[model samples]
Every structure is written in C-alpha cells, then in structure tokens.
Target: MLCGKSLVNNFYKYKRKVWQNVIPIIKRHNATYHPPKILFFGTDNFSLPSLQALHRNCSDRLGVVTSFKSPANCVRSYAEKEKLPLKKWPIEPSDCSQFDLGVVVSFGHMIPANIINGFPNGMINVHASLLPKWRGAAPIMYAIMKGDASTGVSIMKIEPHRFDIGAILAQREVVIKPDVFMPELHASLALLGADLLVDTVNNVQERLKEAKLQDNTNASYAPKITNKLTEVVWSELSAFDIYTRYRALFGYKNLTTSFLGKQVQLLELRIPERELLVQEPGTFKYQKQRKSLLIGCAQDSQLEILQLRVEGRKPMNAQDFNNGFLKGARSLNFTQNKLSAN
Candidate 1:
C-alpha cells in the first residue's frame, strides 16, 4: 500500500524481500572533488582486492595497516611489491587522524572509537554479508553452510562498540548456485566489494548522508568458524545439510570424519537422484561397477562420495579410495572407526 512514494524508505524496511540496490545517494557535491587520503586496513588475500582498488582510484593512500600477528602474508607482500607504505596495527588514534578517510577489509582488529572518528570523512568497512545478517567473522562460510539462496557484500560506516551495525552506504548481492563452493564465492565477493568500494569512496559525502540505519531486529550473527563445527555427524544432520556445510567450509575447515580407523577429509558430498532402500544412517555401501561409495543418511538420502583425502595423504578420486581402502567391505559405521581408535 505504501511502497510507491517512499520506495527508498520501504526498501530500507524490507531489505530481505527486495533486491534493493541502494543507488548512489544522488546529491550535488558542488565543491571540487579531491581524491581522499585513505588509511587502508587489511590482513590477507580477502583484503587485497579492495586495497588494489583504492590504490588505483586514490592518489594519496596514506598507508596500509594490517595485523601484527598476520605479518608476511598477502597484504604485507602486496604493499612491499608496490612500495605502498605499511604499518602494523595497535596504532594510535592520533596517527590514524592524519588520513581523510579510513577503509577496512578483512582486518580482524576492531578500530576503537578514536580511530573510527579519527578520519574527517569517516571509517568504512567492506563486509562480506548483507548488513544486520551474518554480521560476524565468517559470513561467507555461514551463508553457504546455512544454504542461503543468495548473499552479498556490504559497505557501511563504522561506529563504536557495536560491530557491523551501522549505516549501510551500499550493498551488491551474488546468487548462490546449487553447487557453489568456498573459493569461488570468496573470490567473487572480494572483487565485487572492491568495485563497490571504489564507487562509494568516489562519492563519500553523498553516501554518508544517504547511508541507511541497519534494522537491529532482523540481525543475525555468523559466529567464527571452529574445529568442532567441521566435524560431520552423519546421523544428526541429513546428507544435504552435511553436503552444504562441506561446500561452505571446505577450504578453511575440512569436513572430517573418522572412517575405517583413519581421519578422512570429505572433499565433496552429493546426493544422487535415485533413492535406495532404508539403511542405518552413516553406513557406507560400495558399488563395484559404478566405482563409488554410497553412504546412507537421514531423510532417505545417500551421499555419493566424489572426492576425498585420507589422513596424511593427498586428495584423490573417491572411487580409487574405495577400491584401495574399502576392499571387500560393503558398509562401515561412523562409530566403527572411532571405536577402533579408542
């Protein structure tokens, strides 16, 4: 009923339903445009693309501030290669105040209020998920694990104490395909964020004014990835659910299960179209002609093993692994391997 006149306002309200591409807040910045002196913060490959974008756009990039802990990585290497001035974090607010604006990406440290307010233009973050959702460490991984249809990068101005809860300047989404994995999604978002960041920085003043407040009510946290979360519980979660998590956390956190008395990396898990007779969940069934291992799961789903890595060994085709390891065995239980170890 009220969507026409206040579409912008309504888009802010119903952010999830609408593919709201928050068009640049068009307003005249009658004053001459001066490229901002940006203080860039980042620590890894995820932050590299955005840093490169800033360097290409802004002439006076103050320096790179990265984690002292993650030194000698991509950010440091890139800075040295390009001869961009670089410094380690735990830097003083007064020092950060020198720059006209602060840009952060994949920099794990929280910028204190003084540093955030230090920049005359303001500090901005290029986050991997849409604001008010997946607002934590591993948004990309969580989005895939949770089986979200789509997720996007968010550009938002920073505030004290609260993390990722700020006025969103811009957002651009990427659709999740049925078979998308970690590296593909990560690279896509990194590039998308870099491009979006360039557009936002080119019009800092208008974006600040147009930045919309995030709805706290709809906010969801993507807690940091942990070892425990990577352990596959075949009986508790269905084949599809486990497959999705395997897709999401593969590179960073290998989905592992003790199989045949060895820790095996589940590189790929896919549910076949044809259903099989009911069997105990987590029991493996070998098909000689197909050269595949069919693992029964909840909801009558069976996981076809495509790829895997045996502990202390390189990844290989699951068929080869089945022939080599399974031998004459038809099926094995998850607990079978665990019990043997104990």
Candidate 2:
C-alpha cells in the first residue's frame, strides 16, 4: 500500500511539471501572434527627429504622412534628402485610407476625425508633457514657464476634437535641472517619445487592454506663443518668473522690455545676489563691478541682463548696450514696431 501511494505521488508531480512547460509555450505563442502597422505624422524639427528614429528602427512596418505647405515644409525636404517615400497632403485632405495606426509627435495642425478613425488600431500621440496638465500648443514652454521640477512624455490615443483627453499607453518622466535650456529639453523629450513609441507599439495589445483614461479636472491649456506673450511684465512678475520666461521663450522668441523709446530684447538674465531697496519695477540699474544689467521686478529680486538688443542693432552685452544706447537715453519705449520687427 505504501509503495502504491509513492507511485501515485510521483505520477502527479510529473504531470504538474509537464503542464508548467506547456503553459509558457502557449503564452509565448500568444505573445508572438501579431505586430501592428504604424503611421508617422509630422514635419517640424522635433517631429522629424522622432520620425527618422522610428523609420530607422521599424522601417518594415512604418509609413509617413506630412503636409505640403510652409512651416511644415521640412517634411518634404527631409523626405527628398533621405529618399523616404512619403504621402504629402494638405492639412485637411479628403482621403486617408492607407494606414492602420497613426502616431503624431509635433504635427502643427489638428488632424481631422475621419483620418484618425481610419486606423483600425487607433492613433497615438506623443505629447511633451505629463498630460491632463499641459495640453494644447506649447507644452514644453508652459512646463518651463511654470517652473515644474519634473516633466514627462505621454503616449496617448488620439481622440477627435479633444485636447489630450485620450487614454495613456505609457509615460517616461524627465527631471528638470536648473541649467538645462529649452533646446536640450526639446531634444531629450523627442528621443524619449520615440523610445516610448516603439515600446508602446511592441506591446500594443496589452497596453490597449490596460489603457487608463486621463483626468479632465487636471487639464490645462498651453496656448501658442506669440510676441505679445513674450513681453516682460516687470511690474507684475518676480525675478524667478522672469528667468523662467526667458528660458521658456528662448530660441522661438526673445523677451522684450522698453528702453529709451525702443523695445530692448532681454536676451539673457540672472538673479542678482545683492538686493536693492530703492529701485522701482522696470528701473534699469547697472552693476559695473559684476558687469550686470540689473532690471528691477515687482519682488525684491532683480533681473540681471547678460545680453540685449536694441532696434536695428545687433545683440550686445549690457555694458556695451549701456555704453552705446542706454547712457544718454531717459525712458525707453516698448513699441509694436521695435518688439515685433526683430
């Protein structure tokens, strides 16, 4: 009886081992079943880099769609240069019957609903912000403007006529450093988006099944930047706020202020160590010892100008600008012509 019991136990153990091996084989087969076709959309510098990276990595399964007009004209230029076969169409073209899935990075215009729904697998957008937080035009700039300690890239589904309200596929967080500028941040986010995109595509089935909806309550819009928005409001803002504004609008537009009946561009700025109790907001105070151009703000902190430009003049340091323009002038003016022309 004891020998018979031992034989039964061994037989049960052997059966369990066989089932364990078979289950993993079944799962592996399931995992290898399908790979979706992907379409890339965009034409700006940011989009171009990500698209190029995606094509290089997933050339066999990716297609590209871009605009045939100005601003997004680089799409055509890159396609010709790289010999990439691209489908060029106007922003609201009537037909989009080609792709199974779409991925938009920095496509300037809003994609119509028909084109978005044409993809059976659905479209995904790689936004530069954490989503539900910074949505709309300039997320990167908005994040920097808000002085966020950290920001991330989100891989979200494309929903028609909505602003970042789709389900999220994945997100990769990036830490914001004090010295990191806009160009560096932009590049980093683009690369992160490309990587996250590839991973999302690879795991589409599972991610789609487990997608999470974004919270609309936390949503905020980042409007498109303009010259008017770039004007420095010294009377209402602090030095740190001004500093962040400068970094956020750098490369795209220069921050402007009034000086001697002309708009003086605030090229580079820093916080002064010594506080001045006597200066009023928008007052220009020079620190020749530190070679700094100090502009007073609403708060105790001051904006130390490193470089600036006057109307019809090249950008110069505070000392050089002071020596040439600000010395003899009384109150400078921030005119529409002086601010917008450059």
Candidate 3:
C-alpha cells in the first residue's frame, strides 16, 4: 500500500508540471478563433520601432492610440508623419468598441480597469521584464542596475483593476552580456517584444493554454524613475555600483554628482586596476601617466572616468575635462563644515 501510494503521488506531481506548461498554449489556441483587430498604444522611442514594425507588417488590422506632444511621445508623431490612422486618447473613446484587442507596448500610463474590461478578447501588455519579477516602470534599467543575468519580455492578459497580475501568454528570454550597454539592450528587447507579440497574436488560443500564473508571493515592484534615484551617491556606493548607475541612466538620464560646489553629470565610466592611496572617497584623482580621472569610491575600487559633463561645460573625456574644466575647479569637501555651509 505504501509503495502504491508513493507511485501515485509521483505520477500526480509530473502531471501537475505538465499541466502548468501546457495550459497557456491551450488558452492561446482557443483565443485565436477570430483574427484580432488590435489597438497598439505607446509613446516612447522604444515603442516607436515596434510601432513601425507592426505598421509595416500588420497594417491592415492594427490601429494606433498614443499620447500627444510629450517628451515620451512616439506613436502619435509617427502616425502624424506617416499619416496613419491614429487616435490621441488617454482613455478609450466611445468608438473604441470596434477594437478586438488592446496591445500595449511601452505605454507609460497605467490603463484603467474599464478600458481593460471593454474589449471582448482582452487587453495585452508587452512588459520588458519577465512577469511577476520586474513589474512596473523602468524594468530594463532596474534589471541592469540589479545585475540580472537574463531578462525577457512577457505577453500578458490585462485584467480589470489588477497590476501585472494577468496570465502570461508567452515569454522569450534575453541573455545579457557583461559588456552590453543600456541603449543596445533596450533596442534588442524592443525588437524581441515585437516578434513575441506578433507570434502571440497569430497563435492566440494555443499560447493562452500555455500561459502561466505568476507566484504572488514572489512578486516584486519596480517603481517609476525619479531624480533622487538618478543622483549618484558616491560616498555610499562602490566603483562597480557607480558604473552600473552610469549605464542605467545613460542617454535617458545622467548619473549626477556634485563637484566643487557644481553638479557634474557622468555620462560614461570605466574601471582601472591601478590603485590610488591619497584621494578620499568621492574625491577626484588625476592620473597623469594614464591621463585618466580616477575617482575614489566608498569601496576600495577606483572609478576610471571615460566621459563627463560639468554644470555648464560640454561633455568631454577625462583628460580633456581635466585640462579644460578641472584646471580651475576646486575639490569638493564633503566634511561637516562644508555640508553646514552649503
């Protein structure tokens, strides 16, 4: 009896695993009975390329809804330039009842529950990171900053009044190289997202059967990017941390630090092997031999400056910055007296 019970338990476990793997595929297959008329919503450079791809590939069936003239606007401008059928609406309009599916790609705004429930097929979100892990704004940057080995895109069903809690229709893993920068990674993920989206839409029912529910217990939050997070805390972080910060904010935002009573933004940085004993953490050390600006960190590591921009000066290499700007720049003193005075 004991042996028989053990065998039955093992068989059930295996079946459970198979069921978990097969369910989403079955759901997606069932969902694809009708060719979905999609509304693509997003406004950002990241979303622009995907919009272009969808426009070129799925033009007959896809419509676009995007933000107005904002810093992050992507689809509206593209629609205007290409003269494509586009609607600028933060909320779903009265005529939105015609759309079958809502596919959101890098749309910054949090869609309301009413709009999510309006569609018969259901809304879908193309999240940058694997779901239930990095679910919120700035997933790519946060993933890099946290030094994740791999991140992926998730195609999830948007449920009413929920945040990233929908069933995942499909996902594709993306391996991060040690040397990959933020811009390149973002572009690669965006393209990958587009492909996954198309596949999910084409095989909707089969993919939905394979869709998996994320573990609520393991859920983590990715808050929106803020100026405070962009500021460099040199005294509390190591050189490697600083380097990651630089990469995370590159192009979109800058890693800012104060120097000589002026704020300087570091656009890029490298790490050198050579050690310096004199300069304190957060202080700048000029290496005449290597012509590098070695900035001391909270840890023993030294940050080799590659490119930097001063408060009012143009961006330049460490050597050029030293010669042109730092020649007259005073050393920042983070002492109590300096803090009190400032």
Best by lDDT: 1
Task: Give a tens-digit lDDT track for model 1, residues 1-342.
Answer: 466759977677788444334322222332445667898999988999999988888755558987767546798888888888888787888877668899999988878888888889889999999888999999999999899999999999988887788899999988989899988999999999999999999888899999999999999999889777877767777888988998898678777778666788777767777876555778877666655678877777778777888888889876788667777654466543343334
Q: Provide the TM-score for each candidate, comma-separated.
A: 0.84, 0.83, 0.81
Better of 1 and 3 by lDDT: 1
What are the per-residue Cα lDDT tens digits for candidate 3 across 138-194? 888888888889998998988766668888999899898766778989999999988
Per-residue lDDT tens digits of candidate 2, residues 1-342? 999999999999999999999999999987775546677788787787777777766666666778876754776677767766677754333334555677888887677787887777778888999988898889999889888999989999989987678998898999988766788899899888888887888788788888899998888989888877888777778888988888888788888876656777778888776675445677766678778777677766677888888767998997897688667676532333345445
Worst 10 residues of 2 by lDDT: 332-341
List per-candidate RMSD values in Å.
9.5, 6.1, 9.2
lDDT of 3 at 9: 100
Ranking by lDDT: 1, 2, 3
User: Each model's C-alpha lDDT?
Assistant: 0.82, 0.78, 0.77
Q: Runs in model 3 with CA error above 4 Å?
A: 1-34, 81-83, 91-93, 273-278, 324-342
Candidate 2 vs. true structure, TM-score: 0.83
